[model samples]
Target chain A: MYAFNYHKPATVAEAATLAGKHADGKLLAGGMTLLPTMKQRLASPSDIIDLSKLGDLRGIEVKDGVVTIKALTRHVTVANSAEVKKAIPALAELAGMIGDPAVRNRGTIGGSVANNDPAADYPAACLALGATIHTNKRSIPADDFFVGLFETALGEGEIITSISFPVPDKANYQKFRNPASRYAIVGVFVAKKGADVSVAVTGAGDSGVFRQKDFEAALKSNFSAAALDGKSQSAAGLNSDIHADAEYRAHLIGVMAKRAVAAAK
Target chain B: MPTVSMTVNGKPVTGEVDSRTLLVQFLRETLRMTGTHVGCDTSQCGCCVVHIDGDAVKSCTTLALSCEGAKVTTIEGLANGDQLHPMQEAFRENHGLQCGFCTPGMIMTAVELVGRKGHNLDEKTIREELEGNLCRCTGYHNIVKAIAAGAQAMGAKA
Candidate 1:
């Protein structure tokens, strides 16, 4: 790993100030992805603004039909939180499915959302549940937050403070994970609230996680597994790799969506 | 270089290290505590699992500077002097290891698993919990049995 200056700030303001001071600085949330990238020399930042010491950016709250999780809240914390489980059990289940126990202990939701890995599970939840990402600067809806693979709408020097997810009436997530990395080869998250429904697909999109409008429309009418019968997801823009071809991922997306719809409560 | 101080194995230790220094490197190099091994430095392998503030984490992927004032427990800290930890004893009794390269990490992960999941761990749960710790020798059958027996032993002690 390349040598860099590490700053552990006690406040979000201080962390942002440190971030602005360095042109090539990276915010260290739970260093699950950043540290590994640095170790491989793939990302060599001049400064690492460690956010672990920012006490205010660590919590989980449920209020007014929304579940608010702070930036530094670890995956394990989200997975095990009584409030999260009671409010949004599918969100908790998705958090628990990420990587393994040790990885979950250190990987934070904010970091995962910020990194916006195409195969990550959080993006699907964010998009499907219509989450609002609150940064130190402003709030951005999940639809506008994720721009592309490994990218977000976060500007330089801006820090994510918390993410607010509106609790859906019913939601579920199903994924066909890669055996080695455990990343989703094709994951689907289905959410329905009142008459509105949303379907988000991750790990299969060429541009990144995307909303499956067709599936949403189908479920909006009949909110059932059988509602998606005879519907097919096209492989036109899906990701194809050694693990799975685009056609295979397209097929898995439909299958997983059916399963998610069937399992959602 | 920056100075980092943390409590490891119940002993306070301080060392001057580069900001890029990994916690596993600090333990195995600066402090000369070599019990924690680094199999795959990329965080895929759990050869460097350790407890930080009573939670299991991959030390190789964790920065040393991030652990300031934190309590860290490595594989070397598991046993009480000459007496082995229940997990270690169980591994030995069950012959859970073959190459022994992944034993330190496996034991560390197993101990943390017991702390969280408790003693009544079933076979499926044991296998599922051992996802991060990979045994190259494919000695998982005995490893699963050892973790179950070790969890029960730890429960008896408690």
Candidate 2:
């Protein structure tokens, strides 16, 4: 890791202001990724702004059919929160089922989404569950938030305040985890809100979390496992790796989508 | 180098560390708490696991300077002189280790699990909770068994 100045902010505004002062400052949320990268000499910033002390950026709240998580809240906290479980059980279950007890306890949702790793689990929830990304600057729609692999609409030095997930009528997540990292090889999140259906696929896409129109269309017609008998997602525009080829992952997309639908119902 | 002060285990320890210093490095090199080993360097292995304010976290992935005024506990703090923590005792009796490379982290993780959910003991639940921790020893069978025993003992005491 490279030498840099460290500052812990008591408030979000102070953190953002400090971020703007430094040329190559990085936000330290959970350090699940940032610290590792620094160790590998992957990145050497001039300043490190630690966000853990910001009391406002932690907690779970449910109000008027929306589940809001402050950026600093860990996966385990969300997974165990009564309000989160009551409002979005699928989301809570997903949180409980992240990398493991260690990762779930330390890795923050904001850090995962902000980093926008192609294989992360939270992006699927954000995209499929119709979440709104609240930043220190503005709120971005889930679709508009993720720009590409490890990419997002967030500008340099921009701090994500919180994420608000709209409670859908039903939602579920299924992932083919990497044997080692346990990150998604291909994960899907399916949601239904009244007549509207949104299906987001993570892990298998190079362009980041994606909306599968075909599965949405199938589920709209009939929301059942039997309803997706011959449904298959195309291999085109998907990620291929040593664990699985795009063609194989594309098959998993359909299979997991079917299971996710069944689980949701 | 930046000077930082924090409570480690139960003692207030202060040191002058580089701004780039990792929390794992501080614990091992500065404080001589060598029990927290650095594994994989990519945060994959839970070898460097420790407690920061009662939350289990990978110390390798945290900056030492960032822990100012915070309370941290490592594997070294788990036992008193000649008395083993319940988790340690369970692992010993159950033969929970082979290479022992992952024991510190495994114990730390099991401690958190029992803290979160009492020792009910199920294979699937233990398997899921131990996911991020990769033990090449194939010693997971005994590790799970030990965790179950540890959970039972700890819960009974609580």
Candidate 3:
């Protein structure tokens, strides 16, 4: 890692000020992604504003059919959170499946969502559950929050404060992970609330995480894995890498979606 | 340069270090605690695993500044002086290691696993939980067996 100044702020306002002061300042949430990128010399910020000391950005609260997870809450916390498990077990399960125990101990949900890694698992749940991303400035719906691979709608110096997820009546997430890196080769999250249904696919989209409206519509009527029988999204515009081809990813999206639907309670 | 201070294995250590210095570097270089090895500088290998505030985290990926005032426990702190920790003994008795390169990290990870899940972990859970720690030497058969026994031994401790 290159030489850089590190600033630990006790408050959100202090963090914002520090971030604005430095020309190439980066906010360090969990540093799970940023640190590795820096170690490889892929990125070198002039200043790093550490948010781990900011107490305001850490907690889990569930109320009125919604679960609010603070941006700085670690992945391990979310996975072990009794409130999250009761309100949205699928979200907890997704959190548990990320990386491993060590990574989960340090990785944060906000960092994962903000980085918008195409292979990440949180964006699928955030989109499928119709969650809202609350920043220091304003709240953005999950659908509009993620722009593309390694991108989000967050403006300069806009720190994510928390994310609000509406507890679905039934939801489940399924992922086909790359054994080496443990990143999702293709993952699906399925959720149903009353007549509304959502099916989101991650790790397989060329434009990043996306929803399958057709599958959602079908599941809304039938509400079962059988509902998605003979259904498959187009292989076009999906990610193709050495690990998996676009066509195979597209096929796995359907397979994971069906499995998620079958697993959904 | 930045000053970093933390309680390592019960001793309060303070040092001046680079802002980008990793926790493993602080332990190995400044403090001369070489028990924590850096197997694969990338976070994938768990050779640098340590307890940061009682949780297993990769020291290589963690910044030294992030652990300010946090309690850290490394492989060297696992036992009493001259007496091996239960997990260490379990590894030896079970022939858990071949090269002994990944032993420190494996034991540290096992301690945290036992701390969280207790000694009654099932075989599938043990194999699944050890995903982060890679052992290329023993094929993981004896290591898994060692962890099971170590967990039981830790459970018997006060």
Candidate 4:
């Protein structure tokens, strides 16, 4: 990795200021993605503003039926949090299924969502559970937060503070993971709140994560794994890689969605 | 250059290193604690696993500067002089290693796993937790057995 200035700001204001000061400054959370990317020479930031010192950005809180997770909270914390498990076990399960126990120990939800890796697990949870991405500047709905692959609605120097997920009546996330990398080959998160239902697909989208309207509609009528019977996901615009072809991914989407629905509590 | 001070294996050590230096490099080169191996630098292989602040992490991917003032425990720290840690002893008794290249990391990860899950670990759970630690040798049969035995020994020893 290239040597650059490193600053551990204790406050969000200081972090934002430091980020705005340097043109190529990057905010360092867990450095799970950023460090490896930098090591591979895929990214070269002029400065690294470490947010690990920001104590306020590391926690989990549930209030008014919504679970709010601080951006810097590690995946292990989320996976083991009783509050998260009670409020949204699917989110906890998703967190637990990330890279591995070691990676979960270091990787942060904020880093995962901010990086917006097409195959990342958190994006599916965010979109399916109707999460609200709260930045230092404003709040953006999950639907609008993710723009494209490796992209988000975050503006320059806009730091994500926390993500607020509404506790769904029933929700579950299932993934067909790539054995080697543990990345989602095809992940589906299904959530139903009263009459409203949302189905989000990740790792199989050409434009990154997206809501499956037809599946959501099907679940809205009958919330069950069998509801997806004979329902098909179009292969158009889905991701095709060495791991899985677009058509196969489209098939896995149906399989995972049904599993997610069956597994939802 | 960054000056990082930390407690390694109960010894307070300090070093001046490049900001880009990985924790494994600091341990293997500066401190000469080579037990923490770097099998695959890409963070996929668990040969560089060590306990930072009591959590097992990949030292190859973790920045040395980030571990300032943290407590680090490598495979070398697992034993008390001639007395082997229960996990290490279990590995030996069970013939858990073949090449011995992945033993340090495997032991480190297993030690932490036992700490978190305790000695009553099922085979599936043990296998799942051992995902990070890879071994080209042993086919993981004896390693899994060693972890279960180690966890029991740890419980009995405690």
Candidate 5:
């Protein structure tokens, strides 16, 4: 732990200003990811700009067909919100199923999506539900938000204000949890809005979170598990580890997509 | 060294710690609240669980400086002198502990679970919720019982 400056700003403008001042400033959200990286000496910022004190950054509001969840909104908060549950129970269920009780209590929807952990659950929700990552600057579509494994479109000094998830007619997420980490070795989120079905897979891919166009196309034809009974995804870009192989992950993409469709039943 | 200040286990404390001092280290080494154990540094283990403004968080992965001006409740805050918190009581009553290493984290996690969603809770829900906070001792049998009982007790108390 090298010496560094710390600042807790009350407003987003002040926070952004502070971020701009420090050369190696890092926005401190829940620190589920940032703190550990710092501890491991993987990251060392010159200053830490704490966002927890920023009141304007926390809340969940559902208006019209849009579900806007503030960046600071905890997974527990989102999971328990009556409005969120009513508008999109699948999103609530996804939040409720993050890691465990401790992780969910502290981990924010913002932090989870920003970290862009390949094994995270929120990215699947973001991609499948066609959410918009609203930053202090502009809105980045979900398709463009996640750049790569452990990467996102977010830049230094740029803060994510909130995410806008479009309310879908039918949506569900099914994950095959890794035994040790409880992370999705393979998780799939299927969102159907009107006639379009978006299938996003997380946890079991080299590309972090991604859409299965083949699965989506098949499901759009007939939104059922039977649709995936004869189709599968390509294994070229999937992840392989002791937990699971690339081929298995590809297999899981098809299986979980089917299960997710059935779960949305 | 960075000057860190925060309220922990119902007490206001101040200490000059390193810039990278973890909340768990600050609690154990500086503040000496050893009840919150540090099992793993990778944020995987919940043994260092504590409530940062009533939210159960892995202390090992939390920076002490980041918790400035925030209220933190540790495992030691559960018992009121002699009476155990309902979750602790349930753990004791159900023989939910074996090694006792994971109890503090288990109680904290259970407290968080009820705090999050009490009405929407069931046995299956409880089992699904506690996947991250691992307890290698109990084989999760009695731990599940303890959490269920604690949830029931917490609901009754609520």
Candidate 6:
């Protein structure tokens, strides 16, 4: 990693101010992704504004029918949170399935969502569950949050404070993961609330996590695995890498979506 | 340069290090505690696993500055005087290692796993939980057995 100044801000206001002061500053949430990227010389920020000291941005709270996860809450906390499990077991399961136990211990939901890794699991859940991301400056819905691969709607010096997820009647996430890195090669999150259904696909789309309108419509009519029979996603505009071809990823999206629907509570 | 102070193996130590210094570097180089090996600096391999604030985390990925005032336990701290930790003993009795390169991390991860998953661990749970810790030698069959036996031994001791 390159030489850089690190600042541990005591509050969100201070952190944001420090971020604004440094033109080439990066907010260190969990540093799960940022650190690795820096180690490889992929990213070299002039300053790192560490948010670890921000005590207010580290918790999980459930109020009414919404689950609010603080920005700095580790993945392990979310996976083991009773409130999250009771309100949305699928979200808990998704959190548990990320990277591994050690990674879960350090990785944060805010970091994962902010980085907007296409192969990440949280984006799929956020998009499918219709989550709202609360930033220090303003709140952005999950639909408008993720813009592209490794990109989000967050502006310079903007820090995510928390994310609010509505409790779905039935929701589940299924992913075909890469065995080595455990990143999702193809992940599908299915969510149903009353008559509305949302299906989000990650690790497959070239433009990052996106909603499957066709699948959502099909499942809205019949909320079951059988409803997806013969329905297929187009291979176009999908990610094709050494791990999987675009066609294979498109096919896996359907397969995983069906499995998620079947397994969803 | 930044000054980082933390409790390592119950010892309060302070060091002047660069902001980019990793926790593993602080332990292995700064403090000369080489038990926490860095098999893979990319964080995929668990050779750098250690307990930071009683939670198992990859030392390679953790910044020393970030761990300010935290309690860190490495492989060297798992035993009492001359007696080895239960997990270490179980690994020895079960022949869990071949090259001994991944032993320290394997033991640390196992100890934390037992603390979280309880004393009774099945083969599948052990295998799944050992995802971050990679053992290229011994085919991991013996390691799995060692972890299971170690959990049981820990339960008995408790």
Report the C-alpha displacement of residue A173, candidate 3, in angstroms: 0.1
Model 3's alpha-carbon lDDT is: 0.93
Cα lDDT tens digits for candidate 5, A1-265? 5556778898888888898889688888888777777777788889988788877888999999999999999888998899999888899988877777777767788889988999999999999999999999899999999999988998767889999999999999898988777789999999999999999999987979999998889889898889888897888988999999999998888888888999883
Q: Per-residue lDDT for B1-158 in model 1, tens only? A: 79999999999999999888899999999999999999988888899999999999999999999999999999999898999999999999999999898999999999999999999899999988888988899559999999999999999988
Second chain only: TM-score per model? 0.98, 0.96, 0.97, 0.99, 0.95, 0.99
For each candidate, the DockQ is 0.89, 0.79, 0.91, 0.76, 0.67, 0.89
Query: Residue A109 of candidate 6: its Cα lDDT?
Result: 96
Per-residue lDDT tens digits for candidate 2, residues A187-265, read 9899999998889999998788899998898889898878889888888888888989999999999999988999993
For candidate 5 chain A, which ten residues in a row score worst on lDDT? A97-106
Residues B28-89 of candidate 6 have per-residue lDDT tens digits of 99999999998988889899999999999999998999999999999999999999889999
TM-score of 5: 0.91
- In model 5, the runs with Cα more than 4 Å from the true position are A1-4, B114-125, B148-158
List pairs with backbone clashes in candidate 3: none
Q: In model 1, which runs have C-alpha deviations exceeding 4 angstroms?
A: none
Local error of candidate 6 at B60, Å? Answer: 0.4
Q: What is the lDDT of residue A142 in candidate 5?
A: 97
- Name the lDDT of candidate 2: 0.88
Q: What is the TM-score of candidate 4?
A: 0.98
Q: Candidates 2 and 3: which is better by DockQ?
A: 3
Computed on alpha carbons, the lDDT of every model, listed in order, comes to 0.94, 0.88, 0.93, 0.93, 0.86, 0.95
lDDT of 6 at B121: 98
DockQ category of candidate 2: medium
- Model 3 spans with C-alpha error above 4 angstroms: none
- DockQ for candidate 2, C-alpha atoms: 0.79
* Clashing pairs in model 2, backbone N/Cα/C closer than 3 A: none
- State the lDDT of candidate 2 residue by residue for B66-101, as single tens digits: 799999999989987789999999999999999888
